[model samples]
Target chain A: MKIAVVGKGGSGKTTTSAVLARTFARHGHDTLALDCDSNPNLGISLGIGEEATEALVSVRDAVDAGEEQHATSMDDLVSRFGVDAPDGVRLAVVTAIQNPEPDCP
Target chain B: MRVAFVGKGGVGKSSLSGSFARVLAEAGERVLAIDSDPMPGMAFSLGLEQSDAGLPDDAVEEYEEDGRQRYRLREGLTGTDAVEQYAQRAPGGVHFMQLGKARGPQWNNRRQHFGFQRLLDDLPGDGWSIVGDLPGGTRQPFLTWGRYARTFLVVIEPTPASLLTGRRLARLAETARAPRVVAIANKVREPGDAERVSSRTGLDVIGSVPFDPALADADRLGKAVLDTDPDGPTATAVRSLVQTLQKSEEQS
Candidate 1:
């Protein structure tokens, strides 16, 4: 099953997503938690240590900086960018644009 | 005293900005609360009945800038004029304006976005104390939505996630050459909560609003904490925050 947690900032969306993902994983589901927020912190909420969470490079940054090639498929994306969180949940951060250029929507 | 409240999502940016604007207005300062978040939470905090209303469609006009389609405020309208013409009147006489809210699957606030940006760029005079409530995370700050403000209030809670985001935002503010950046610790529950936030984010804690049940209750009831409990802990703390801000502005 897929779930998307959405809310305004400071509304516990990350916390809720982490809890739900962990719960599904413990219940024998192969869960994939996607941190799609520009300020991604789902790794921290999913029992990943702060240092490791911070060290997880986002797919967009990695690809944009030429550190890694863009994944050609969903499976490739998972294997290339996903980090192992607690309870066997595969976590991947999509993108985080730290500094967007002006007039470049 | 233009200020923008920025922090991680759910970190009380709206709550503080809304309350601060009202309190500032109550003190006889002309306040314009600008909500740049597409989610539009400032109206609720400002105790305004209209939650989804934004700048009118006529507020913007199509134009070509650098051979690209763009939107700007209709000619003959200044940012101050936009406020006087379209800003909503909230409790305590605070004038509130918002970049349009997201209506559906597609982001439908483009016109409002460009229009508000243009308005902010052309805001006239120093008569109004602008309090801008930016969207959560680093996206808006990185995009320079808060560039107009003289100060950036990076609200943070005593949590790892909040601290990380706050630290990132503070750094971004500095990189953007913001005149001043300070942290306002919110939902501080423990004795060391404020200190922890300060240390973690590397920002001086200007004021700390305690974790108050009244605030939660007010949020649950879809009301502003100040309206629900005017003399409550959160309100009192916010009031003190206003005073600190004003004093610092005077000195600076």
Candidate 2:
């Protein structure tokens, strides 16, 4: 089953989400989760070990990037680009825009 | 163990959450972190490079599942396929994932498609742990996250405004009849901060993370606080918090 964790910013929404997801998986559920907020951090929360979450290219961004050579459907979109999360959890996220300020708000 | 974190803005929830994950990993537990916040910086906190961290170029596939609007990876791909192919591997063995972000001129059109919803529906069968970093505020929770998880964890600061947000979040979770609703007193500057938050919100403060300048500095420097200072006060508190959470899990 899928679960969504919601909260205000800086409230530990991502951290709780990460703990819960791990708890579920450790309990033997092949969990799948996605970051739905505008300020995405679930990748880092999950411990992907990267300095930043891989901002998945959205269909709209693909079209804007001029990579949509042909009309694509959801089925093909993920098969071609869906990211493989650790421990068998699949992840799909929207694209991240480059922000100028490096500081947290 | 599926839980979501919620609270007001600037309460240090993300940093605490990241530290919690690191602590768990140090304890040899596998973890999956989901960043739902739109601002996007958990990776930096997790010690991931800004350039290397981000979602894939093609993260959405909009379509109809059973004659209703739905979203997921290309139609035929299983959730496992998505995990194996797309999930980015972060430090400390934690698997990282994110929802699609709307950027540029097509923002309006992109917002209309709920690809993230589709993904939540198609999550693979469980085994490893999952953590979701939700957006800041109650508005986003109502959009589609209200009933998604069994547990609701509210993180708040000592301030009245943060406590107010926590109270609202508790009410929201209660209205939804979630199995678990708890709060964490984060960035506590005084002795009674946790008690004050608990007394105000009527939700037990499961953990209290102290104010740590070192951690704040790490954040400002764009580095994971744990990576910057694993044995610091913040990390130490997170470790204890993790233990408390684990014990609670056992009791329940």
Candidate 3:
């Protein structure tokens, strides 16, 4: 089952998402938690240590910085960019805008 | 003094900004609260009954610039004029305005975004003390939404997640050449919480708001903390914050 949690900032969306993802994984479901926020911090909420969570680069940033090649398929993307969190949940950050260029569309 | 409240999502920026504006207005300052978040949150904090009100559709005009679609405030209307014409009167006589809220996937309030940006750019610097409540995350600051403000008050909480985001936001604001960037620690429970946030984010904690359940209850009830509990800890802290900001502004 797929779930998308949405709310205003600081409204417990990340906390709720992390709890739900962990619960599903512990129930024997193969869960993949996607952090799509520009300021992604789901890893920290998912029991990943702060250093490791901050070190996990988003796929968009990696590709934009020319540090990694783009994945050609969904399975390739998951394997190439996804990290294993606690409880066997796969965590992948889709995108992030760290330093946007001035007046770039 | 023009200021923008920015930080991670859910960091109590709206609460502090709304309360700060009302306090400033009560002190006889002409205060304009600009809610740059498309989520429509500042209204609730400003004690305005309508949460979704924004500038009228006719306030903006669409045009093409450099082969790109762009939006601008309608001709003959300056930013100050827009505020006077469209800003809603909140409690304590604070004038509140917002970028239109997102309606759906396809309707993303694009015009309002660009129009408000233009309006902010054209706003005069002499009259009102503008308080901008920017959207969460790094996008708006990176895009220079808070450029008009002379200072950036990055509201932070005592969490690793909040600290990381706060650090990034501070760097972005500095990179944009913002005149000043300071941290306002919120939801601080322990004695060392503010220091921890300041150390992690590398910013001076100018003001700290204690973790108050009354503020949360106000949020749940769609009411401002000042109105819900006038003498509450959160309100008292925010009033002090306003004083600090004003004093610094005077000195600078």
Superposed by TM-score, candidate 1 places the C-alpha of residue B192 at a distance from the truth, in angstroms, of: 1.4
Tens digits of per-residue lDDT, candidate 1, A16-100, equal: 9999999999999999999999888999999997777777888887778875655677778777889999999999999875664
B229, model 1: CA deviation in Å? Answer: 1.1
TM-score of each: 0.92, 0.65, 0.92
Error of 3 at A74 (Å): 3.0
Cα-based lDDT at residue A92, candidate 3? 91
In model 3, the runs with Cα more than 4 Å from the true position are A65-72, B65-68, B100-108
Interface RMSD for each of the candidates? 2.2, 13.9, 2.2
Q: Assess each prediction's global lDDT (C-alpha) against the native.
A: 0.84, 0.64, 0.85
If both were scored by TM-score, which would come out higher, candidate 2 or candidate 3?
3
Winner on lDDT (1 vs 3): 3
Better of 2 and 3 by lDDT: 3
- Candidate 2 regions exceeding 4 Å error are A1-105, B51-60, B65-67, B108-113, B140-143, B146-148
Task: Report the TM-score for the A-chain of model 1.
Answer: 0.87
lDDT of 1 by residue, B1-252 (tens): 799998888888888899999999999999989887756578888987556556787889998889998988888988889889888889998988876544456656777777877887887648889999887887856455777788889999998888988877877666666788899999998999999988888899999999988888887777888899999998899899999999999898
Against the true two-chain complex, what DockQ does each candidate achieve? 0.55, 0.09, 0.60
Clashing pairs in 3: A9-B10, A10-B9, A10-B10
- Which candidate ranks first by DockQ, i.e. highest? 3
